[model samples]
Target chain A: GESVGLHLPTLSVQEGDNSIINCAYSNSASDYFIWYKQESGKGPQFIIDIRSNMDKRQGQRVTVLLNKTVKHLSLQIAATQPGDSAVYFCAENRDGATNKLIFGTGTLLAVQP
Target chain B: EAGVTQFPSHSVIEKGQTVTLRCDPISGHDNLYWYRRVMGKEIKFLLHFVKESKQDESGMPNNRFLAERTGGTYSTLKVQPAELEDSGVYFCASSQLTGSNTEAFFGQGTRLTVV
Candidate 1:
């Protein structure tokens, strides 16, 4: 079955440093991708998203880069904070399949202050 | 505005028992979705509702699980004769039918433990 997966299970970083989480998806028909952050005891929250037509999209402190050639995507958070510690999941929106977001296994980001 | 909200933050039920989880999506949002994450696994989609009609339920695990969204408002998921494998965090989300903002708003989730 075609699925989305994360490159790392966990990543640790200093509070002031930048953090990057990677994901690879197998479904070639997917046209949209999103990044979600889930803290303990909470559901996944929307972080950022990118469309296939674009290569990069930037949010407040976050940036999403899409590499269609490699079927890869990444989320970069600048000046990571302790509050940024959470599990980050990359999801692809399968349009033909009802536009449901297919999520990766997620990468746990631990930011130490 | 209020975001997606799920009822019963936690539940612990014995095997063979039945449990029902609820979700109330944001007002006027016609799209609702149910997803669950078993321990150590990725969040998997269970079903999706477009208003009162079910758009897709291909992700449903089995006949033991049933979901309904009556009146195109709140939705419910009932697990009958629950098994230990049914234990997990059930999350509900909502979004618009079509728009540039394709992001889905998620609830805190209901933690179900089948003991």
Candidate 2:
């Protein structure tokens, strides 16, 4: 069985500060990873994604780091804002699959305004 | 383009009852998927439809769950004799194609509470 898990269940940060959430996955066969932000009562929203071939990828205000050697992935948010408070989840997809994503237990990001 | 849309945002049903969840994928999207989160657990894939055909259903929990995509348009997930464990948020997502790099657009999800 393949599983993706978070290192922390909750992370708190001050507004304007940087936040980093960590995830560890067991399936080395996974070729793609994505980070999603889920607001309360809303569906998980796409934040950023990185292919296993790359070590890192950057988005508007977010960055995703992948460490295949350690089977770890991280999502970093710069200048965290109040609107950034949400549950963040990491998902992995295998190359040959039909793009079905396996999600990890989310880490709740709490920004103190 | 409109995002994935699901009907009856919330439903409360008794045990052994039946319920159907509908999902309308983004227009022109060729890939649709259904996932579920039970209680506080992580979201798990239920099945996937590539157009009007089921491409993968390996994650479906049991035979009690049936999914359909008649015209490769919208899709439906039906659960009969729903059990207490079936109470959770059911999410529908769509992507432009079936590849490892495509980003999925998700719906708000249907919250099913089986008592």
Candidate 3:
């Protein structure tokens, strides 16, 4: 099993503020990384992903940064909203035919209006 | 198109009982996966099925758990003699394509409580 961990278990941010969540992974063989947001009583929803070759990738309101040298991953949400409050997880996929994903302990983001 | 669908969003069973969970993947999806999250733990992979075949089941906890995908469209996971350690949220997911570049869609998950 892969070891992925979050720096913080919970984070509090003000609405309209930018929020950054960080993750550390020990698997050097992992080449693909993804960020998922899971609300209470719901399954994880994909937010953004980055390949090892890429350092950064952007989506509608989110940006995913991958640092292979440090083996760290981070998700940045611009202008956080109440709806953004959820548990965020970072998953790494090893480069192989199986493409199995190992998920890290999640960080709970709380948006305060 | 619909996402992955799981039956019986919640199940509570006595220890040493049998429980079976079902999952219906999206249309044309060839990859199906089962994951579980025990209380206060990370979500762990249980198995993966490619159509009607078991692609990888190394994560399955024990022989007491059985998973089958008969027609390649849907899958079922049966746990016999349920244990308290088996109480958790069971999630099912499907992907249209293989590889890490593709995205996997997840169902709401079935909460299993064993007492």
Candidate 4:
């Protein structure tokens, strides 16, 4: 079975510093990728997404970088804040799979003020 | 301007019991999906609905799980005679359309605990 995994299970960063979370996926056929933020006892919230054709996409304060050559994906957060403390997950969607998303084992981000 | 919403944020039932989780997607969104994550695992897809019809259900775990999207408004996932393995967090998501590039909005999720 194909799987998506994160390089780190936990990350701690100081406020105002940059944070990076990495993911590796097994399926080369996946064409769409997304990043989601999940707080405790809550559902995952959409952050940003990038297509396989592009290398990077930016949102309000988040950026998603995709390296197809290595099947690696990363979510970079600029000027991290306390509100940014949450679990981040990277999801991949296969080309033919319309609405199915395969999520990675999440990285827990802890922002220290 | 509401996002996806789910009902019964938490559920605890004994084995062999039945539980139903509900989801209300964003207004006028035509795509709906179901996903779940068991303890210490990643989130996995369950099924998808396009409008009022089931577009894909290959991710459904077994026949004991049933999903319905009547009127294409709200969707429900019913687990009958649930087993201990069914304990997990079930999430529902929706998108404006069904495409390879569309971003999906997720609900708060329903956490089920089977005793």
The best candidate by DockQ is 2
Give me the candidate number with maximum lDDT. 2
lDDT of 4 by residue, B3-89 (tens): 999998989999999999999999999999999988748899999998999998989999999999999999999999899999888
1 against 2, candidate with superior lDDT: 2
Query: Comparing 3 and 4 by DockQ, which wins?
Result: 4
For the predicted complex of model 1, DockQ is: 0.40
Ranking by TM-score: 3, 2, 1, 4
Model 2 chain A, poorest ten-residue lDDT window?
A: A1-10
Q: Which tens-of-lDDT digit does each residue in A22-87 have in candidate 1?
A: 999998778989999999888899998899999999999999999999999999999999999989
Model 1 native-contact share: 0.45
Give Cα-based local distance difference scores for all models. Answer: 0.89, 0.91, 0.90, 0.90
Q: Which has the better DockQ: candidate 2, or candidate 3?
A: 2
Over A2-21, each residue of candidate 2 has an lDDT whose tens digit, in order, gives 11353448899999999999
lDDT (tens digit, per residue) of candidate 3 on B34-109: 9998874788999999999999999999999999999898999999989999988999999888887888899989
lDDT of 2: 0.91
DockQ list for all candidates: 0.40, 0.52, 0.46, 0.48
Instruction: Evaluate candidate 1 by giving its C-alpha RMSD to the native, one decimal.
Output: 4.0
lDDT of 4 at A12: 98
Model 1: per-residue Cα lDDT at residue A3: 16
Per residue, candidate 3 scores C-alpha lDDT tens digits across A1-113 of: 11134343899999999999999999998989999999987889999999998999999999999999999999999999999999999999884576678999889899999
Candidate 1 segments whose C-alpha is farther than 4 A from its true place? A1-8, B99-101
RMSD of each: 4.0, 3.8, 3.7, 3.8
